[model samples]
Target: RVLVAEPRRIAARAAARRMAWLLGERPGGKVGFTVRGERQAGRGTVVEVVTTGVLLQRLQRDQELAGVDVVVLDECHERHLDADTAAAFLLDVRATLRPDLRLIAASATTDAEGWARLLGDGGTDGGGVEDGRADGTGGGADGSGSERWDGRPGKPAPVVSAPGVSHPVEVVWAPPERPVRPPHGMRVDPALLDHVAAVVRRALREREGDVLCFLPGVGEIARVAGKLGGLDGAEVLQVHGRAPAAVQEAVLSGADGGRRRVVLATSVAESSLTVPGVRIVVDCGLAREPRMDHARGLSALTTVRASRAAARQRAGRAGREAPGVVYRCWPEAEDARLPRFPSPEIAGADLTAFALQTACWGDPDASGLALLDPPPAGAMTAARETLTAIGAVDTAGRATERGTRMARLGLHPRLARALIDGAKEVGARRAAEVVALLSEEPPREYGDDLAAAWRTARHGGDPYATRWRQEARRLEHALTPETSARRGTARGGDGPGRSENGPGRGGDDPEHSSGDPGRRGDGPGRGSDQRGGGGPSRGEDGPGHGGDPRGGGGPARRGDGPRGDNLPTRGSDLRGGNGPARRGDGPGRGGHDPARGGDGPRGG
Candidate 1:
């Protein structure tokens, strides 16, 4: 069996389709693909195409990869976190477990020598090690390598290069005349959009083949597509991560019946699958990079200058079929200032999922792995805290039984916790539906209220709704009791009420409500004590005996009052207010803090 891993689902499906065509069979015949929430493999399948995330999950389950013969890591140049981690772990397996397993990492414009070194080719230095042992003298178990296995460190694996067909691509500098606002917060300046649209019109009028324009993201793609107006005789289609599958298919299928096409797409079209009949390329000179504000706990996509490597990849799209022209929106001098390569996702992304995977892999701190880039220390600490809060890991930083279950669910650790806890509160089906919505946020058109969006997607007819339904079913299946039993582990019994007994549960007294017998609830000079169930003991000279007077000192702590159940419940609405505000209240009355109780000036 052969495994082909792609970065995105669309690319995996495209590769599977091309392989099936080459094999002279239908889509699910000898070649197949398996992406999240979808699978298209059959009994006779020999080559399986899958996303990098899917491949990582497979590695976690079966370290030995019992039956697979070869694994191909495609698009390694992208340097996605999953691909990088998968490559590192595969190297570990090849070195210690399966020397006979063949591993291949393929890319178009990657750091060949760096990857060659990474793949055990000692590079030009001849300093690679074979078995990672002190002596470094072990050979392959299967005797496939007389010296050591392919990619053993210090042992250089042969580099195989295949040259591509020659095609001249003319570079046309089309920088805007005036300085425009740089891309910020997903907004490309209108000035840049106008210039790009004009260039597209010029390309259509002067050039012959279809025009492929690159934008930073979906929002920009939509804006530019709208700016293009009516393309006299050409079809204006947009392709992005969230575009409908049919629209993406149309873009990839090419224009039919001699209709000239202008395909406005995001970085998704930079590489991977080729766009047929594309002879003109319009580069926007901007791309989106994943950024995390660790201090503020906010993660969002930030607009950034397109890297030189990405520009090269985008320009090559135009020349895939024939000689073409690339229209760059930035000046040639600016290219030198752009980053040479895109930042790896591990450097800035939230590492909660990666941390959990590492903990489950027996490397809690991820220090033992042979990763290209070690995870950041601060991010890993935050990840472990989140796992602990979710009851996925114990105080010792070991994966609990629940942690393994959460990891297998294929959702982020936080979302998995929400689903598991929500199921206990609500039904499993309802929890799954809500979790699915959280997994892939519903479109903005579906509205802001989560419940409303859930209802709309539950009954809506759009492609997103269809995908939501499929994901909901998968989540439901993953959370079933039978599945847990089959996995030979019981669900964790830790709940809010049982697991949160700590010193901070009370104020002032460390022994309060902690089941300590040394401290007495009622003491001399203390006002009427409720715990001892006695009334106030007043002096004889004091006022005439009155009914039981309540003690007044300060707010009662947990285990202090008669009830002894003052622990704050989890997910409680702790906002200060006179009472729950009514709907349609003004800003001051709508959950905003006012100067006083009633309507008054709002305070920060």
Candidate 2:
């Protein structure tokens, strides 16, 4: 059996489907896939595609990978932390227990030499890890070993370079005529997208089999798709992580009977799956990445220029099947200024989850692991501190019992904390729903209220709601009934103050509504540190997008809008999910579950 690990769930399914088609059978036959809560494999399945996270979980359960003969890490150049960790773990397995296991780091363009060195030739069975460096022809990171390269012990592995594309690709520079503002904090200049739409039209008019337009996010894809309407019966579809399953199938299946298709996609399409019939590529030259927002206590998605390697990958899509043309949406000279490769996720994303993973793996500080780049010192420190506060790790930087449970859930540490604690505050079902919503986030069409969004997902039959149901069910099943210390505490009162009694002990002497002893300087049962961070003036400790409210992320840290729910709860007007922000929707009203939007009660 061969196991192919893709970076995202969508890619896994698409890859499986593509393979199944080639085998003259449907999925569940020789080629199948298994993602987080979904699976489509049968006893006869020989090739199974899964997300990197799923492969990591399998390794945790059984390091031997028992029945599998080979493991392939597809799209190795993406540089996701999970993929890197998995590669390291796989190398370790190959050197020790699974000597017979074959590892392959597959990519259209990669530093065969660098990867060849990192993945020593243990034999033909030794799987090669990607060096993540770009080959000069374009398809990898810097290929510069100078940038914190993995110095792990391994002899050079054999190189297996695939030949270049058989088709020729013409490149056309299509920069907007007028100067446009650069992208910032999830906001892309409208002018740029408009220009991209124009470029797509030009491609369809002058050349083309099918047009594959690359955009940054789902929102951008939707906007570009919206503009390509009335294209004389040409189908406009979207391809992203959030895109519906049927849509993915159609995109991969190509336009039936040669009907035209304008498939607008995200970076996932860079190397994941080939959208059949695509010969014209429209490159927007923008990508979105997550960065920690220190002021907001949240991780914000920022829009930036696509890396040069990524632009090359996008261009390659056009020339996959035949000679094609790529419309570069920026000036040819400007391409020189673009970054060589995307910033490794380890460098910018919130490291709390990665830290917890390392802790659970028994290498809390990650000193023992072999990685391409070490975790940033400050980020590691912050992540460990957050984990300690959440009781997921001990002072010695080891995983606690609670931490082990959190790791098993495959959720962010903060969200897992919320799921466990909120299960006690609210019931298991409600808590799971809310946590799932917080984790995956409801669609923009799901309305502005978080609680209302849950109800919409519960009652609606749309693709987003279906996925929400699957995730919610998974969380609901994973919930542990163990009664913890944080259970039943007043919401937003998870500050530092020991209390075995009701409402916790802190601040000025006061009394809980239960007549038990409590503290003041806060709402009843609240703490002196109003924002709920364990620190003196910290503002975090939450499961909300407002992460580590001053300490560890949970809820009610920042963006605690008028409802004090921290999450954007729908009411008179909740903008950008910053919670309620209008008259009659201000905080402090009893009998209302600010988030639930029902009579359940107010809290996370």
Which tens-of-lDDT digit does each residue in 140-232 have in candidate 2?
323233221345344555555556544778999999999998865445677887899999998888995999988765556666677888898
lDDT of 1 by residue, 211-233 (tens): 99987644455567788887789
Highest lDDT against the true fold, candidate: 2
Give candidate 1 regions above 4 Å deviation.
121-153, 481-604
lDDT of 1: 0.57
The TM-score, computed over Cα atoms with residue i paired to residue i, of candidate 2 is 0.77
Backbone clashes counted, model 2: 19
TM-score of each prediction:
0.76, 0.77
Worst 10 residues of 2 by lDDT: 507-516
Top TM-score prediction, candidate number: 2
